[model samples]
Target chain A: MKPWWIVVRKEVLESLRDRRTLLSALVMAPLFGPLMFSFSMQTMLKRGLDEQDKPLQVAVMGKEHAPNLVHWLESQGLEDVPAPKDVASIPAAVRDAKPRLVLVIGPDYGKRFRAAKAAGVKVYVDSSDQDSQRDFRRLDQLLQNYSSQTSALRLAARGVDPGIAQPVMLDEIDVSTPASRAQSLLAILSYFLLFSTLIGGMYVAIDATAGERERGSLEPLVSLPVSREALVAGKFVATMAFSGVSLVLTLASFAISLRFVPLESIGMSANLGPKVLTGVFLSLLPFVPLAAALLTLVASFARSFREAQSWMTGALLVPTLPIMVAAMTGMKPTALLMAVPSLSQHFLIARLLRDEAVPLTDGLLSAGGSLLLTGVLLVFVVRLWRREKLLG
Target chain B: MIHVTGLAKRFGTVEAVRDVSFTAPDGRITGLLGPNGAGKSTTLRLLYGALTPDRGEARVDGLLAGPEHTEARRQLGVLPHGAGLYPHLTARENIRYFGELHGMSGATLEKRIDELVAMLELGEAANRKTQGFSQGQKVKVGIARALVHSPRNLILDEPTNGLDVMAIRSLREVLRGLRAAGHCILFSSHVMQEVAALCDDVVIIAGGRVIASGTPEQLREQAGTTTLEDAFVKLLGSETAEVQS
Candidate 1:
């Protein structure tokens, strides 16, 4: 047999024969991406729809100051949650967590709006938690709508047309088509894709290295006609094959899930259009090989089955840092920025989400650079294989 | 078949094998006798190319041993201290695995495996995984795997270190037969009787260097001793001489 062919055949056969390792390699990889995406998107989507539909659940602490404000909030589907007897008693209710939000009225009452000196309503919110922040935001929006409508009516009551009193108004007509939302949704998908590529071949890589050592069969293999570089290369190629399969399956799963999803329910007219999917997928292609090679090199150094697995899982989760940054606040993409691991892909996904044009050069650089790094990693693994201290 | 010259190996600051030199000629059983940590295994590893020496060389059939000298390795067989067979694979599979690595294939591999199974008397345990095999069975399998490839030079490191008395005897018989078959056999051991009974030539190592080398009787006569153990102690100059030096 050709020397590398011997290695490749042995690796593929052994990985398949070992039921646990085979299943872990074949199953967990494809399972993780779809399961994670479906559950996460489902949760976020459900929570979003629920929030818009949930009767705002406004808690009015100072109802006596302006009865009109309370009535206005009711019209917006906000139900007031009665508070403790007095404003001094409000702190205990917040401490006991009886209410998500606490809106206290100042002693000025209706007189402040008449004077316009202190038209401010005190909003005491629990910013310490997720539910609190979300609840506070909805309440804040409800109060703004009330205040703006009240100001307009107040002007009209004074014989001044509200349009005349206000010379200008802020208008934000988002040009982001339905295709854009679909593209932004791809941000999380990019993370999933990136994570899938790095972790998919984890089992195969670990099996090819630590499994061979643990079986006490590595030294003999090392003492073969083949060079250590060839052995590492063969194993690397097998691992990359496993990773590529996962990337493809994950992308396919996303395509299927997005097609059936009701985007309009969330008030997004986004069509996970073919163009956006193609853009995001094309941008991620170069990373797949690099990620597989990098993880394979890392897995090759692990001393045991458990160590290899842990290293693989760690590689997948580490990308979450960049994913979170872009998902939380998508800063503008720059030339140097595309050089970052997931930055360019993320911005690309975001632009496609917002239905904006992306420079073709960014996608090429991201994939090409990733492929180059993979090559360097392959060289490093070859050298490591020659070192005796790492056999385990 | 094996040659060694100044085969010194060191780990960091400590010298594991220092200025060690010897040859186990073809068709002979050469005994390597040493106390614990006396660089016996280190020397064997250097000989088999498992480790690189800080200085000197180990040549099998005129080819130098090192990480890249795999082609040179096909001529040798090794039973590393405990038989480096995978516990998860059956004894048969382990032997076949190593055989394949040594370039045995197809009919040659199957026929050789059968011959080893019969020779090692592992018919019952051959198909059963080595994970729960008794130490004696493991030793037997280790021996079978080392000799199965029909390597001209056989290097065993403390082959009977932990084998039971019966297992030791069985292994001795196998070694005696191999010696008679004219395979160049070099093995290390601390047991003097094993060396006295099995080796035609014995080399005594102390503090990473050879202290005495000769036939067991020659060394015993040179030290005015009746037994190989006594000859080893006298020629190596016991603890007192070591302390004075």
Candidate 2:
């Protein structure tokens, strides 16, 4: 037992001493979520709010016909960026972000409006840019509104029933919690966090132990006066340390991002404060040890680092089963569902982001069960220490 | 210090180490000589409690080779094949880290580290990360790590696996000095000259069985040959001897 403690202490020291693993565990992954999430979420939210119903910038090209059409769009709030008359200039202007909408008025455009005809105007648009699309759609709606408003006025001028010009109007309302709104986008991010904790740490864990054996270092380790049980614990803790750090970082990232993402822009009022973020971090805690244990089992039998990496990767990918299922059909955060490995973290995190209190039972059950599984793994690893092939 | 009786290990259908037996006296250098797959490494693993035999028993200071076995291992030190140093750690850090694993603390661990560094002539490289060191330097660091905890028994597996002549000579000198100080030393090797020069007793194994084990002179006498190499060939069979299977 004493000697095994030495092995465990050594595992930690070596891990800390290794610049690559240290950087990945303590610095890289932890900051990854905060950095990427905050940047993306803030940008998206700002764009969604600031750019809503924005005016389209149209470039005029070829044949000045309907001065009324140009006057109609200016009234709709479009400020045009002057464009060259060449047809090729349409693509070039859109590419340079000079104009989002390029309208080529034909020589017969005045004849078309006077005839009250559905004569077409060639309009080229940049379809790929979401902002450009929003502006384009608004411009389309404004044009249609202008034509309708003119028709109604014309009918009124004829002394028809003004009341009969329009009988109906349409408005829309969205009723969803701030958490649910955030969950809509963050569910994808959650899947990635789950993978890093489970799959990424699985690689680190298996490689630490099984890699040593395949390299034939296990014999020296065994030949020392280290207890088998302590050796298992040492390896287990080292792996879980890597996982725990990642879990904390991933949750902290979401928590910080949500709190600071300015959800009011999207009409969401949810706040990811100390309590909520803490709950989220707590929710992910159980998965850390469970993931480590599963990977440890796979690594113990692996013949080399590559073999362990592949096998543990396959094993860690087991989380994706629940991820795929959750993605296919949303899961309700039930006590039973939340207690199951892989799925539970994602399911509960989705709820947590929606500002739903993670049920105490779910957190306890998941943490308790994972810790129990860790015990089972520790037992197995200890037994593995006595195996000749693995030890030597 | 270590006893083996009819030990055997089977991996599914293939038996890696078969029924074999030997005794290692305390305060003596015991050489385990065999071909690459002849189970010499396996035998060493049994003594370290790394492997559990499917049959018979291997005991170190009366401790059976089993899962969780550690009582006898406390007085044991090991320098595995290739040194097994984590490449990222400095030499001083590596020694302190393993020493801590053996429960050496604060002042004691520091003192031990200093002594090992000084003894191994590694003052200059002690602070350098192992990644940049030459093979001989790494091997010396490995020896320092094994001796850090001051175990009564030391096991070196292919201690000279890849070394220049100077490094090998240095290693031989270290082993000889440790032997002189009454430390139980066990090493596995395929080199005849190394074992003949450093070992006080030799155990020659072939086909997973111990064919001859005695003092070098005794083994030579048993084979009616003057040289240890000649005696090994006679006992383990001719170098040109062919196996049908």
> What iRMS does model 1 reach?
2.9
TM-score of chain A of each: 0.85, 0.74
Q: Tell me how far the alpha carbon of residue A22 in candidate 1 is from the true structure, in angstroms, after superposition.
A: 3.1
Error in Å for residue A229 of model 1: 2.1
lDDT of each: 0.76, 0.75
Q: What does candidate 1's lDDT look like per residue over A1-392, in tens digits?
A: 54565566656655666676556556665667667776677678888887777876656766788787777778878788876677777766765667767777765877977676547787766677678788788888777777777778888888888888568888998876665655556556667777776666777788788776776557555644456777887788777777777777776777776655566766664445577668877877777777767777777788888877777777777657766775568556777767666666666666766767777788777666667777888888888887876554
Write candidate 2's Cα lDDT for A120-140 as tens digits. 677777788876777778878
The reply for model 2, stretches above 4 Å from the true place, is A1-5, A49-53, A56-173, A177-207, A214-216, A246-262, A294-324, A350-352, A356-358, A365-392, B12-14, B66-68, B90-93, B96-129, B147-152, B236-245
| Number of clashes recorded per candidate | 6, 4
lDDT of 1 by residue, B1-245 (tens): 88889988878798889878999988899999989998998888777766778899989888888777876677788887766666656788778766765667899999999998998889888998787888889888988888778988888888887788998888988888888888999999998888988999998998898888888888988889988878888877763387577
